[model samples]
Target chain A: MKTINLAESTVRDLNQALHDQAIECTEREWEVLEPKGQHNIACGLDQNISVDIKGPTGYFCAGMNKKAHITIHGNAGQGVAENMMSGSVRVKGNASQAAGATAHGGLLVIEGDAGARCGISMKGVDIVVKGSVGHMSCFMGQAGSLVVCGDAGDALGDSLYETHIYVKGEVKSLGADCIAKEMRDEHIEELSELLNRAGVDEDVTAFKRYGTARQLYNFKVDNTAAY
Target chain B: MCGIVGLYLKNKALENQLGELFEPMLIAMTDRGPDSAGFAIYGDEVPEGSIKLTLRHANEDYDWAGLAGKLKHELNVGVEWFNNSKVAIFKIATSDGIAEAFITENAPDVLILSAGQSIEILKEVGLPVNIAKTFNLKGMKGSHIIGHTRMATESAVTMEGSHPFSTGMDLCLVHNGSLSNHNRLRQELQREGIVFETENDSEVAAGYLTWRLKQGDTLNEALTNSLKDLDGFFTFTVGTRDGFAVMRDPIACKPAVMAETDDYVAMASEYQALTTLPGIENAKIWEPEAATIYVWERSSETGVK
Candidate 1:
């Protein structure tokens, strides 16, 4: 395993090394040390490799990632794994707002709680949080699924679209158009697969599904009050 | 976008190093906000019934020394003043209302930055690093400090528009993010007899908190009220006489991270600001939940925990 110390190496050097190895088709395991909660660490990686960050990271860590498996041992700042495509980002600790925001296709997992808007405007990214999520966790989500193991804050899945939400705990409130839906066999199977992928063990039967009511999908005049 | 940094030392051992720890944190956010910077430091509690006011004037040559003598003679009270460029802080044995009224009537051009027993606010339009040096912020010692670097999305870049806005005694607020309904809220607050010093949306938020506190709401309750009443994307870190608090808007588009240890509790718009803090690696770091009030007060009533 190759090790890079953020205190000694610049972010550019780290990214360049990762990019070079990815382009060369050299599979390498990398470890980042002394990250010290720096911003933009391991961002914009397009490698099919594994990178473990020893400490917390600031905004946009692993942003725009593609085909990389990034793990943060400590908490992450805002927008961790944002806009990711075809990769997995895991945070052992909590994540700040907008985690995995606007991502197209990837799996993001948070072992601890997540701040607001965890999957805001998300498209096709699957998110699994083992702990509670703050308000508006799935605001305007377009596709994929959000699985929460703990209670959800107010306005969960506000104005959601297409995305499926499975919460094992109580939801403080739901946003416009986002309503609890039936959890069928297919949904339970999907949630079980996601939980398994995130390495979380929980009974699929304990979760409730939430999705858009489809009433405001066409922007009818009757829904003006909701807007 | 803007950057905010707050450091509240739970252990009195870290009091003297408040500025030393906060300076690097504030400067780390230079990329987020470069237009202006400001800070509110809490320390040196004045005697009972006395107040401290930090004031500023547009004219660099404004005679702060002369104003101190005049205030002493006119108010018939003891007044001590410290001048820094366009800013001057006054300590007077008088009520906050009386001193504020005196300044309003006598020195109409001087803008009051803060008035409290323990808070001293210094802010100006410049890069965060430059502003820190200009105010000699690294040399100031306090129990807790809150700082802001503003990019000026809602208002022009001026000292008045800069953050760490103080609308209540020993209370100051620094915000990151713009308010969507500031104009309407400002009008509402104005109608309720709350005066504003700037057109900045953050000032309205500060005024709202001050108004709520005046109505007998605790700081935590006031922050809770803000979540329902204020409309916008905001991450606020507020400093008070006894402690500091943090709250994020429900949507919470703006970023905020907090770290707590046995010795101190620190908050920043980004975790990078906290990297330089002592014992940060072992600190219990987490992202503050949306619309939740996280308060840390020095246990004065019942000794330190």
Candidate 2:
């Protein structure tokens, strides 16, 4: 196992060294020895790399991520996989706001908690969080699926369009146009797929579903009843 | 628009106001509002009876002690003692008008804002470090800090109108959105002899808030009043020497996040701006409650866990 430790180096030095070493690590690299508030540590990776960040990160740790598989052992700051187009980021600890905001495509999994606006304005990103999200989570979401294993805060899925939200726990309040929806067969299948991808071991059948009721999708006089 | 950030170290509550917690975070975001930057930092270690002030008007001759006395008088209180700076620091908790009277006399466009217990305001057109350092910014020993970077959207980017604008001696305000009813509020407040120097709608906000604070109303009370009285999109953070306050319009138009750790708290205009703060042990983040005012006090030595 090749272990490049960042014992005394800042997140900046470690990232630079990783990039300079040209080590296209295939397996999970042993450790990020010492990381103090490092930001954008594993951004924009195209290789099939597996990384294990030893400690917490500052912000946007794997933003714009693609192809590589990454994991962080400790808590993470805001915008973890923001604008990511593909691949995966597994956060073992709680995450800050906008965890997977504006990702066109990708898989983001959080084993712990996430802050407000998780997956906000998400464009085709698949995100799974184990804990609660603060208010206005998934605001202005265009597409994709956001799964929450725990409770969701106020205004969940506010101003959403097309994006599907699956929450296993109780919801504090629904956003402007968001309403409860029946979990159908296709939804169960999709939830299972996302759960498996995020390494969530729970059975998909246990979770309830919530989504945009399509009431406010387009403005019209007749639609006013549902809106 | 300004890059304003602050964090109040409550034992357990949402993050906000007092200026100390936001230091470098807003500094990084200084590029967004580089015209000028000033901060109010509060700390547990600062001695009593000493005042901290930020001085930025280079063209004028000023009297620090005399200004401090005026601060004591107009606030309608007694001054025990004060510490002088290009920016002055006051350790005495006189009436609110004391600080305002001083700022009024000096006319350097001062901001009587603070994180939890310190007020510092500097007005100039430049980078963050340029103005912040002149007031010994990085050297501050505080629990939180709030600052502003000016983009000069509406009003002339003068030293007077720069954020953290002050109305009450202990209160300063920084804003991120336009006030739709500024003209109306301006007219109303001006009719009451509340003088304004610039066209920035935030000034109206500051004026509105300061007037309310002077009426013996709490920060939260004034902020709550703003929801109905003030129109348009706004996300504002206000700081008092001992407490921090925040308010967002009903629309949640502009962005501001409350992110905190056990020891520190942070608020910023964007997620990218908080990319440099320390301690994120499961850092839970939240948005300001729309049209709601949240106020918090710094964790004091009273040992109220």
Candidate 3:
């Protein structure tokens, strides 16, 4: 196990050390101490290692991760694990806005509530929140799946495309062209697999699925006045 | 991108260390706003019928004593003042408009940053660390404080453009986002007798709140009404005589994090600012919801009201 103290070394040094693992794979497990809510800790790691961040973090913590399993012991600031390509990131506490934003791939499991824009513009990421999510959770989501065990705020999946959304609790209001869809066997199986991956113990059959209505996918002259 | 930080002490024992606890929170936001920095601290309440005014002059050698002497000789009012650098605090026993008018008429160059029973605002165009040091922020004691570091998006980086804009008695505001409809709103407020000091959009926000408060609205009421009337993205931390309040716009593009401990309630634009506070690890921290008003007051039985 490799230990890095943020109090003693800079975030650059920490990230550089983590990035170095891709070149030469010696140490596989890393522990970060005293994160002190600094931005960009353990970000942009391409190696397949496990990192445990021991404290709360500021913006963009573990952002743009390609292949790394990172776990935050405390709350994460804005855009945590944003734009990740692969691997998994787990936040033990609440996450601020835009968690897993625009990530192409990965599994993000937030044990606590997530702030607004939880998985905005995500391409292929699978996010499961054990607690509620704030408004505008998955705006313009192109792909991926968002699972909310608790209540969801307004505009769950606005202007979405090919993204699957499952919620066990109340959704405040759906966005334009977003509506509740049938929960089929395949969806339940998919949601079950996602919940199992996120380590969440919940009844998959009790969830409702929502997706794009496919109304605004193409421009229509009849809707030109609304535009 | 501006930075806003506020500390409201719930425990009376922590009052004396308000500045000491708040300085690091302000300095931590240096990267967010490096053009200018300012803070409004609420403490040292004057007796009834008296007000404290924080005055700033362009020249550091501006004789504050002479100004006080002139006011004492002309207005026949007792004036006690404390001067530091180009800023001075004048405590005078007078009515609402007399002292402020006299100072403006007598000394046009001297800008009255704040006038209230308990509020003193210090702000300048510089780094947050240097501004905090210049104001001796670490040694001063207060019950509550609201600070701002500005990266000046909507206006020039002038002292007048700095935040913690005071528009009402014992009430000041520091903002982290830009106001879009300030020009039209400023015209409407000016027509309603609300005074504006600068072209900055944040001052317009302060003026709008002052107008609402003048209409017999409480601090929380005024902030709630601002959501409907004010346009643009903003996360504001307001300082009153009793305590402080935090409000974010409905859009809430700008960030705001709040933490509440047994000792104090701290708020900043980012979580990093609260990291330096004592017992922060155990504090109940959360992001304040959009278009919501969170107020903490000493007079209230419960800290949040």
Point to the candidate with the largest DockQ: 3
User: What C-alpha lDDT, on a 0 to 100 scale, does residue A122 get in candidate 2?
Assistant: 98
Question: What's the i-RMS of each model?
Answer: 1.4, 4.4, 0.6
lDDT of 1 by residue, A1-227 (tens): 89999889998898888888766856569999988777788888887899999988877899999999999999888889999998899999988888999999889999999888889999999999999888888899999899999999889988888999999999999999999999999998999999999999999999999999987678578768996
Q: Compute DockQ for each candidate against the true complex.
A: 0.67, 0.14, 0.89
Candidate 1 docks at the CAPRI level of: medium
Query: Considering lDDT, where higher is better, how would the candidates rank from best to worst?
Result: 3, 1, 2
TM-score of each: 0.89, 0.73, 0.98
What ranges in model 2 sit over 4 Å off?
Answer: A1-41, A54-60, A73-78, A121-123, A139-143, A158-161, A203-205, A215-227, B7-29, B41-57, B60-120, B138-145, B177-180, B231-235, B248-292, B298-305
User: Between prediction 1 and prediction 2, which has the larger lDDT?
Assistant: 1
What's the distance in Å from true for residue A170, model 2?
Answer: 2.4
**lDDT by residue for model 2 over A1-227, one digit each (tens)?**
44555556555665554454346554445366445445677766665567788777667988887776778887777789999888789998878778999998889999888877899999999999987776788988999999999999889989889899999888999998888899999999999999888878876877888888777766688767895
Candidate 3 clashes between residue pairs 3 or more apart in a chain or in different chains: none
Tens digit of per-residue lDDT, candidate 3, span B149-180? 99998888899999889968999999998888
lDDT of 1 at B147: 94
Q: What's the lDDT for all of these models?
A: 0.89, 0.71, 0.93
- State the TM-score of the second chain for every model: 0.96, 0.76, 0.97
Candidate 2 chain A lowest-lDDT run of ten: A21-30
Clash totals in order:
0, 32, 0
Cα lDDT of candidate 2 equals 0.71
Query: On a 0 to 100 scale, what is the lDDT of residue B240 in model 2?
Result: 70
lDDT by residue for model 2 over B1-305, one digit each (tens)? Answer: 56667755654332332232355676666756888766555454234544444444343444556765775666654544333344444554633334545565665564443312356555556787677655555555544456678888778867676777776655788888888889989999988778787888989998998778777777777888888888888888877776676777876657676666665556776544565555543566555656777665653422111
